[model samples]
Target: MKSNLAYLHSYKQRLAFISVSVAIIALSIYFNFFQKTENPEFSKLTFSETKTEILPLNIAKFNPNTLSTEEWKALGFSEKQVATILKYKEIVGGAFTSKNQLKKCYAISEEKFSQLEAYILLTDEAGKKQNFKQNKWVKKELIISGKFNPDLYSEADWVKMGFSERQAAGILKYKNYLGGSFVSKEKFKECYMINEENYAKMSPFLLLPSKTPADFNPYKKNYAKEKRIIKYQNFDPNLLDFEAWKKLGFSDKQVQNILNYKERFLKGSFKTLDDVSRCYMISPEKFEEMKPFIKLNPDNFAVNNVVNSNVEMPKQKTDFAKIDLNKITFQQLKEFGFSDRAAASYLAFRKKLGGFSTKDQILKTYNIDKELTQKLIQMSTLSPLIAEK
Candidate 1:
């Protein structure tokens, strides 16, 4: 009987423990299941509601690079404008640091930048802020030597100087290169033809529109000869249209002269009535003089053939330039002998973060197979100038 009581007491103790566990679990459920959910400290809002309430006229004060395409459209930017900015970024480097610096951006308008200045973050990789800055100084002038022709100059008095004809002609030619009509005093000193002595002598009251004579052309006509026609006549000069010149009793030499002059002097046949009227033969002064006699039977006009004669075959640039792996496009990566799959992997890895800055920067982007990165390190691409022109 004593043993039976001991066993029964142990059994009751075990049951009580199990009962207590169940009661604790039931109370936990009652508190948790019946309780109200707590409110979150902050909540996300829909873009439309946020824009309507938050934007106001201050929409102009945002940074465009950070905006979504929808947000860009809200500010009156077209898809093309956005695309231009992206393409310019790819070609010329990335976005401007601030709204004012956005002047370097190709397509964003002044009005649009004003609208977008408010939202710009202008942060670098380290999270440091950026601001607008400009370089205000002018570039220093350059000096170069060249040759020229004197008859091309407006004035003839330049011949009085003891300078060689070639030297004077070269000075004039240099002026032409700069798009200046006449030689500059500052430029003359730049060429060193006018030393301190000559510069002092010539710097006083200048008389220009002075004539500088041209070298006699071996090709120029002898105006003294009857064979040398002093003036041109209004006429069609095609050998194909000999009858037209013959009707005016034009000599064979005269006709030959006219045809040769047409080939040598004109760029092309009449593109329009105005173009035909510009020709020396058909010029306004001459066209009006010859309008009564002018005739046109040929339906087809000649194209500008002189351009073909003068065209220099472009020297084929050697493809000696190496591609920079860090900066290269996916297409460029493939060109460097990366298989399409490997190239695609590199792009995907870079796209997740930003692109690599150096060949070593590739290691920071995840999922790049270690073996592949190691293999790429064995070789490197160089800039075009570094490899060859």
Candidate 2:
């Protein structure tokens, strides 16, 4: 009977221990997850909202075109303002040539421009050109000699070569943003700061490539390396988003130029690989590198073309009298009033069906109509190149 009493007492202690353990576990769960739901202040203690830090503005003489994004922020502009300025410069094809040009940026307030105007250093070439146009100054030539590669020269080197601090900084900034080294002297000349006189002075000392001057076209050859044939990726530039473009190794500036060209020049369309090739900013090598990957869609092209057109007819229809439809690229289709996407679509269709036997086949293409096909038939001819292909 005494043993039975001891066993009962031990059983009670075990039950008490189990109850305490369950209570502790329940409390732990309540604090871990349920506490956040039950207690708002506890949730706040765990996670804080993210805040953007604004930099203090420094008032100094600065070139809006040349300033890095960080430098713009340091000068008191917000991150958004900096991005706007950069985009403005990019759309306008790099660098503000005049004080008035800087004023045109939407982000720049009158008060801000006024405060920064005194500090802004206009390139000597630009200043002189504007002055000459205004009858305020005459231009002259300066001659000098030194061994220098303008592409490789630092800001200090430019300063030693008689450029002002601001001019030197502008040149370096421009080169840095260009994404690659200058392949020729002509490219360096395109700098807003570098005028004919300055170029003449620097030309003798500048190290040039071994190729004949005739061989180096600045617009076509932006890279220093020889062109290598690369296998094309299956993609379409017209349909590519920003991230996709960046993935293709295009510079930010180049990508922006493509977007700008689409909106402004091409009327929000691309008509051909040729149209893309015509973007002088894209070097021949780069275009060739991309030629394989660009897939064109015609339906998208047709819709945009119809929507964007103000005139009764496309402007390039008259120009295609001599162009062979079979021989021409989809870019040529753009001449026949097709949007880039439409042109590409036609080209893609032609490839898939082996070749167009008649203009009637075009009606089967997405977004292509009988009247447009007839007009294309009237405008185009079969070329020997088409037969070969």
Best by TM-score: 2
In order of listing, the candidates' clash counts read 23, 8
TM per candidate comes to 0.18, 0.26
Which regions of candidate 1 fall more than 4 Å away from where they truly are?
A: 1-63, 123-389
What tens digits encode model 2's per-residue C-alpha lDDT throughout 163-277? Answer: 7667878897666544446655666667888876466445545686533466654434444332332234787566765656666667765675556545545665677888788
List candidate 2 stretches off by more than 4 Å. Answer: 1-142, 145-149, 152-232, 305-389
lDDT of candidates 1 onward, in order: 0.45, 0.62
- Candidate 2 has a TM-score of 0.26
Residue pairs with backbone atoms closer than 3 Å in model 2 (clashes): 57-76, 61-119, 270-340, 271-340, 272-331, 297-341, 298-341, 298-342
Best by lDDT: 2
lDDT of 1 by residue, 1-389 (tens): 99999999999999999999999999898766654234232244335532321234644434444456677666666798867776765564444443344556768755555555545544222222333357443321111111233334321224334454455556655554434433334444554444554343343323333333354222232222322432335443222354455454456544443343334334334333444453322324334544554444344344544323322222232121334554556665543334566577677766554545455656543334334355444444423212111
